[model samples]
Target: MGFLLLAGAITAEVAATTAMKYSDGFSKIGPSLLTLLGYVLSFALLAQTLKTVSIGTAYAIWAGVGTAAVATIGVTFLGEGLTVTKAAGIALIIVGVVVLNLGGAH
Candidate 1:
């Protein structure tokens, strides 16, 4: 259940970030509104997950996963460069998140 909420939060954040790329600095109406709505829902769902999940754990997963997903989208669909540095950075973020979760288990 908590994982479900966290997943929703991740999805909403990813959607919001993707829409932001098309928002033209918030000058575009549709994408701008979608961005606003997506963030609202993301935070709301994240807050719900915090009821059962520790803030450090939840936030680590949320931010880490969101960053990775956005970077992947940028490379795959947004014509952004996928250099070795970018790949290494994403890998580090995933490793850090996993370490945080593992540490929290104790």
Candidate 2:
């Protein structure tokens, strides 16, 4: 259940971040509202996730996955360049998240 909530939180966070890119510095009404709503939903779901998942594990996963997903989106859809260094950084983030989860399991 907690993991499920965490997934929701992560999705919401990703959506919020993606929307933010289109928000035109909050001058665009629709995307700006979406950004606000998405972040609020993300935080609410994350708070619920903390009830069952350890804070360290949940936060690490949240931050790491959200970052990786956003970076990927930026490269794939936002016309952002994906240099070798960027790819390596994303790989490291994933690995770090996995390591945190494994360590937290014990």
Candidate 3:
């Protein structure tokens, strides 16, 4: 249940970030609203997730996965460059998240 909420938060955050990219500095009403809504939903879900998950573990996973997913989306869909350094950073984030989960967030 907690993991499900965290996943929802991650998905909402990623969607919000993507919408932000298209928001044109918040001048575009549609994407701007979407960005706001997505973030609101994401945070709400994250807050619910914290009820069962440890803050350290939940936050690490949320931030790490959200960042990696956003970066991948940027590279794949937004024509952003995927340099070796960027790839390495994403991998490291993933590893860190895995370590945190395995280490036990008690």
Which prediction has the highest lDDT against the true structure? 3
Residue 98, model 2: Cα distance from true site in angstroms: 0.9
Q: What lDDT score goes with residue 11 in model 1? A: 99
Whole-model Cα lDDT of every candidate shown, in order = 0.93, 0.95, 0.95
- For 8-82, candidate 3 gives per-residue lDDT tens digits of 999999999999999999999999999999999999999999999999889999999999999999999999999
The reply for model 1, stretches above 4 Å from the true place, is: none
lDDT of 2: 0.95
TM-score: the better of candidates 1 and 2 = 2
Worst 10 residues of 1 by lDDT: 97-106
In order of TM-score, best first, we have 3, 2, 1
The best candidate by TM-score is: 3
TM per prediction: 0.94, 0.96, 0.97
Judging by lDDT, tell me the better candidate of 1 and 3. Answer: 3
User: Candidate 3 — which pairs collide?
Assistant: none
